[model samples]
Target: MKPPSSQGLRLTCLLLALASLCLPIPLWKDRDSLMQEEKAQETGGNLVLSRQEQQLNTKLVSLKKMEIATAMTTGQFPPSMHFFRAKRLIDQSKVFNIIKLMPKGAVLHLHDYAMLSVGWLVYNATYLPDCYICFTHTGTVRFRFSKPHPPHPVPAQCSQWVLLESYRKQLHNVSEFDRSLVRNLTLVTDAPEQAYPSQTFIWKRFEEVFLIASGLICYAPVFKAYFYQGLLEFYEDNVQYVEIRAILPTVYELDGTQHNKSWSVAIYQEVTRQFVKEHPDFLGAKIIFTAHRMLNVSQIKEAIVTAMALRAQFPDTLAGFDLVGDEDEGHSLWDLKDALTIPYSLGVNLPYFFHAGETGSLLQGLLLVLHGHFHLGAVLTSHPLQQQNFSAIILHFKVKQCLSQPQVLTADTHQSN
Candidate 1:
């Protein structure tokens, strides 16, 4: 009895814990009955519903449940299937029409170049009187607007410049050529995954399409009309407002007159104003000035300065600024910090709407978050993250205030195609 030994004390505590665990606690004898009772109690607290409302809710639930069950059992395709696969079945289903009838909110992330149909671009825009076409050695085509001229020294990469009208006449089937051109200008294919094996490959083709499209739409006459048509298309789809990501390239006239960036921005403003006037139901639109990330530091600074000037000129229409390119191959945001700081130094506020984390890199995403301190408010990304690291970054850094709207994933019908 000279004080209990340590081992004896441990054995005593263990026996006491086991005895407590084995004791019959006053828990519900029938868990199923308890669950039903609690559920009834909870439902009893809810507001009373009419018989018709209850029936409608039940019917909707049953329909959704049946759809899911059928999809699972019969191996039938569901609406939630991959967009490419679902799109194939769209023509046969009412879902496409249902979506078309739905009122879509402001389309905030559309590229100006891709707002219209490629068929319209090739057939309508490129079919203009002065429109010129050049075929590259790499089996791609480029279109532009210029007055008719005799054949001259052509670029080493291009075969020669010819009138699109004449070129169409030479083709055995003009309709087939137009269709093939549309296919080249878009990602529509039988097997998209096979055609575009990797992001790098796909991005290369994407940029190529932009190049081919820019030549057609960047013509002064077509540029103005393009904006109008784009607005009309969006309005017809029940989208009242849109924010277009635009690269304000130098627009050229058929007479070889080059218009500066300001002229292009002015045209956009005028066209948008006129469209809104004509379609009073349409709310409005804004432009997010974008520059290629492949630009040098000087070029980036120039783009920012140009954007600032446009913002000053059209304060209501110029929304923000962004760097657009294949993020995987472009320079990092940190690398261009000095150039990006120009707006701050010049006493102007050009808030950054940067494309970040598209490559799904934690380091790149963190850099973007850190840059948020200097007016980097929103990031455009398509990558889906399941990790908690993104949330952890936001919480740990207290970046909620800096990232005002968080990440925006731009979705367009053509992207799925």
Candidate 2:
């Protein structure tokens, strides 16, 4: 959507002012005096406010007024609307109360690579590709880049180029991509109105980088470094804990021996424990062993077994199981229910946090199945709840719900997703 113009913002502010009359009389009875005192504190000796600050203050007043009015009329706003509206109420009249009202306990299903800010990856890690490789001239999320067989000598431009990391620390701003590598590689715009984009478009580029990063993480030490970096990034966002969904991609070891998924899990668990000990603010972290949705029945069974064993070996850290990837073009989770039952039989309370309703049909089918077939202990769906039985945290693009807040690991589960 296009950014609101100045005129639009002013009109919205006016609407908000009229809406403020709907607030309970008690809330506004002392509001004028409170606002006067605040204005005095902000302006010091002068009553005149700067143009920009005046505009902002006016906007906040109008927004809170509208919120109170809506709440009075509707009884309560939808939780999502509450969050969005509260974010706009910058004056802190009832900010604390609003936060308390929202249930943002745990975010369960975030992809690791996508969770970190792009500025960090590019600037902090120096993640720029030395060689460009495009999969096609059109849209694609995966591509092959040249291996730095002969690492390029440090470029002289490095000394002059503005570093993304330094800019993050100093200015805390990210540059929006003006052009994508392809018409749809880093974006897929179908209409002219959608042309101008923000960090959201950068997210598409970030996904492409994950293919390279996963390969890099297969190395024991590289995995350690990446995990450490990811942890720090999460903490910066006030997340106290995380449950990373890691799948060690299939790759050959330096010695020509194939390092299978099980081996990768073992190494990942060990590293996770050591990392947790190193960061005190972090209460804990865990793994929800994931199987690719595209994998066949046999592979799915083996993946579940791998997870079961991991749970036995690392009970506290291996919390559950998940089927990851796009569900649109694959077999439904119900299609493999028989094999899924195997994990439970083997003493792995590997609760299924399956990615069910990620697609339109899949979402509907899974909702019906969860409602009828199994008394789903908890369910995560992109759709909002119709009853009080479920609680959820909606991510930037996905939503997660479970029977009860999955044992809070101390970190925001939303951060994990």
Specify the highest-lDDT model's number. Answer: 1
Candidate achieving the largest TM-score: 1
Candidate 2 residue lDDT tens string, 134-180: 23233332222223232223222222223323333454333332123
Over 1-417, each residue of candidate 1 has an lDDT whose tens digit, in order, gives 599999999999999998777653434446666776787688344457789968856866776576567667867553444344555555554444545766776766568788986788877897778777788988888777776562345545876788888788878888888888998788666765576666666778778888889888888888988889889888988998887889988888877788887787778788888998999888888888999888988888888888888889888888768778766678777767777778766667665555454543336645645766344343223212212222433332222221111111222322322
- Candidate 1, residue 396: how far the Cα is off, in Å: 22
TM-score of each model, in listed order: 0.73, 0.50
List lDDT for all candidates, in order.
0.70, 0.50
lDDT of 2: 0.50
Q: Per-residue error at 89 for model 1, in Å?
A: 1.7
Q: Alpha-carbon error at 167 in model 1, in Å?
A: 2.5
* Model 1 regions more than 4 Å off: 1-85, 150-156, 361-373, 376-417
Worst 10 residues of 2 by lDDT: 401-410
